[model samples]
Structure formats: structure tokens, C-alpha cells
Target: MDMIVQSLRLGEIEIPEEKLIYMERPVLGFEDYKQFCLIEIDEFKPFLWLQSTEKPAVAFLVVNPKIFVSDYKIEINSKEIAELDIENVNSVETYVVVTLSDKIENMTINLQGPILINTENQRGKQLVLVNSDYEVNYKFMTHTVEEETEVNREVPVEV
Candidate 1:
């Protein structure tokens, strides 16, 4: 089954129907749109576009939080699990929305609200972690500016 989506970046593209993820509840701030497709691009490895099926121009950049935060974890209660029709916990795929900035250094990830998808059922939900250590603006990269350098050259030093 071929599905067509008016992608924000790639104009129109054909995707498989099974590839579309159905959200039991709308993602935060996007209440009207529930169906979305995860589009992968070679240039954006480890990051994919969550394109809304209802709104062609609506899309989000999402990435697996575990990639950067190795200890990242979200505890979903039985209610949420059952809501997504998730039979196996291991089958859940987690992703966090990425916020890009004019300065690459200011790029951040919304760790507090992570999207959990049940691959088995293609159902998903954006969950807000209660009492989580994560932050909404978790910087993708941290840099420290050195007042003085050996060559006296101003370079953004990554910490």
C-alpha cells in the first residue's frame, strides 16, 4: 500500500501505509493532528522527520534520547501502556523532539516530553515524565568559551 505525504522538505513522497504511526492522543501543542510518519533521510542519521499526515507542512525533528543521554529512561504506567495497546515493553520505541536554533550550539532536545511508540500497533503518545531529571531545553552540545588561548584565537571550546 502506497501512501503519499506532502513533506515539508521533500515535497511529495510515497510511504507505506504501515509506516504511519497513529497517536492515541495528540502530541503536545499539536492536538488536531494525530497521524504522523517517520521519514528518514541519509543526511540526518539518528534524526528523522515526524511528518503529520493531516497537515503536510507540519513536521518535527525527533531523535532517540538514549543516543545522547545513555541513562535516559521514561517509566510509563500500565494505563499508558494499555492505551497504546503495547503488549511488550521492549517493543516501545522512544524519541524526543529536537529544537533547532540559528546557532547550532543552541540546539536542544525536549527530554521532559518524550514520544513513545508501540511498533507492534503503530500507536504512539507524547508523554510528560513526572518527576524526571530531564529538561525541555537540554542542549545538544555544550561549549565553554576560553578567555585566553595559546594562539589567541577565539574558538568555541566544546565541553
Candidate 2:
């Protein structure tokens, strides 16, 4: 029999698949982290925070590329894409790492470094875009949210 559950609670609240957010592997400085979940702290706001499930000591704030950097673009390596078993680019969801500052105006999002993953397949990869004209910590925050979603950050690109 095939049994399906809508949402699972990591601590207390139940997180549904529709609310689950995925992240890729972290860069050299954050190599240890692999799995993460995006939790929505607000309903009106577009900003979401990433929390590491693999190590439990890692987390980052992320945002939609269209919100802050108007001309931000990222192209990942084919090998890394293959490793994640990504059959097509459409299967992947992209999110940039963010840094929150004391003042809301000082926020930034890491456009250069991005987290890529296949939400359906449950695999992910943190790739560095060689030609990306962005930073490791791109902050773009005008306000903050208290809740977000979480999902597996890494998935095998190939069998």
C-alpha cells in the first residue's frame, strides 16, 4: 500500500511539500552543510530563510533574484548538474544566500554563489558560477519573516 502524509514536523509544526524549500551544497567555507529547509516567517513578504538539516549549525537568508538584483544571472557547470541527476534545468529551483545586517537597508544576497536543486528528485548542489558577478553573501532585506520551509538540499545527480 502507498501511504502519503501531507506534512511532517521537524520540531513542532508540520511542514508540507508545497511549503518545503530546497538548497544546494555550500561553498568552500560552508562545505560541511548539504541538506536544508526553507521556512516562511511571513505571508506577505517574499524573503525566506534557509536552515541546514545536515549539520544543524548552518543557516542563511535567501530571496528571489527578481526582487533585488535586476540583472543577476547564474550558469552552473554541466558536470555538477550531472552529479545532481538533474535531467533538465526546469527541474531545479535556484536561491541565493543572503546576509542580514543590523539595519534593514544593509541586506544583501549572494548572486555570485547560488544554491541549485531538483525539488522533485530531492537532490541539490552548491555551485560557484565562474562568470557570476555577485558576492558570497548577498544581502537584500527590507524586513524580516519569522517562519519558512525546509527540504533536502542534496540529491544524487546520477544513479
Candidate 3:
């Protein structure tokens, strides 16, 4: 059965009951909200909203880390897999929360911790990587400032 949910990001929308995810370990700083739904809109191709059903005003921008880092991978311990009731690795989906910067060029994603969900059971958990070089604030968009070198500087020549 489909249920109507009010989202601040998308306004009132109807979501299927199967699409509802129950978080075993809710997102950091949002422990009170265990029920959430992932909303994807075409306009925001690379980003999706993890809207909290409990609180319509609360939503998170999340994306698959692989979208930015094609080689992104994580090892899930047996404990985590069992907790999520993940039968097979293929049933798991990973999403990282995106932190938007005032300047779009500076936007970054949290790779150190990722939200893993089991599609079969609709259960999710956020895992914090303990033995990894993944940065908490990994910048996906590469931006650099041009340097002013002496050789390139304009020199005034005597007439």
C-alpha cells in the first residue's frame, strides 16, 4: 500500500510502503528518526533526498559514492550484514551523505561513514570505516587556484 508523506524538499508525495526503510542505526545526529524514504528526482540527477518520514522538515542529500569515485568499495563485517539481514552482497546499496558548500565547487561527501541498506528486507545502517583512508570530507569536485609566478608576471621594460 502506498502512503502519503509530506517532505520539505519535495512537498507532499505518495510513497510505497515497501520503499520505507527502517534504520537500525539512524543517521548521525538523527537518532530519533528511524523511518526514512529515499526520494529521487530527475532534476537532481546525481543527488537524492533521504527524507525523514517522522519529521517532514528533515532531509538529507545523499548519493552513491561510486558515482564520484568509480572505484569506491567497502568491506562489511559479518555483524553488519547480519544486522541488516543482507542475504547477498548484491542486495546491499551504499549511499554517502553529501555536504553542500556555499560554493558548489567546494561541495564534499562523507566517505568515512556510509549508509548501507538491504533492499530485500528494507533495513539500513550507517557504518563508520575504522581501517580506511577514506576521508570524512572528501571533495568530489577538483578545484585549484592559479598561481602567480615571477616568470609569468608582467615586467616593465625601460623605453
TM for every model, in the order presented, reads 0.87, 0.66, 0.87
> Where does candidate 3 clash, by residue pair?
none
Error of 1 at 55 (Å): 0.7
Among all windows of ten consecutive residues in candidate 2, which has the lowest summed lDDT?
1-10
Model 2 CA deviation exceeding 4 Å by range? 1-13, 16-24, 136-159
For model 1, residues 51-100, the per-residue Cα lDDT tens digits are 99889888999987766666676777778877888777777888889999
Which window of 10 residues has the lowest lDDT sum in candidate 1? 150-159
The residue-by-residue lDDT of candidate 3 on 1-159, one tens digit each, is 998889976899899999999999999888999999999998996679998999999899998777676557788777886788876777777899999999887889998888887889899988888998988998877734223231221111111
* lDDT for each residue of candidate 2 in 1-159, tens digit (9 for 90 to 100): 221222233233344545443444554487766555666676525766566655444556666564555445566567777666777766776677767678768867766666775766767666666765566665455534333343233222222
Q: Is candidate 2 or candidate 3 better by lDDT?
A: 3
- Give candidate 1 regions above 4 Å deviation: 143-159
For each candidate, what is the lDDT? Answer: 0.80, 0.57, 0.81
Steric overlap count per candidate? 0, 29, 0
Which lDDT value does model 3 have at 131? 92
Q: After superposition, how far is residue 140 of candidate 3 from its true place, in Å?
A: 0.6
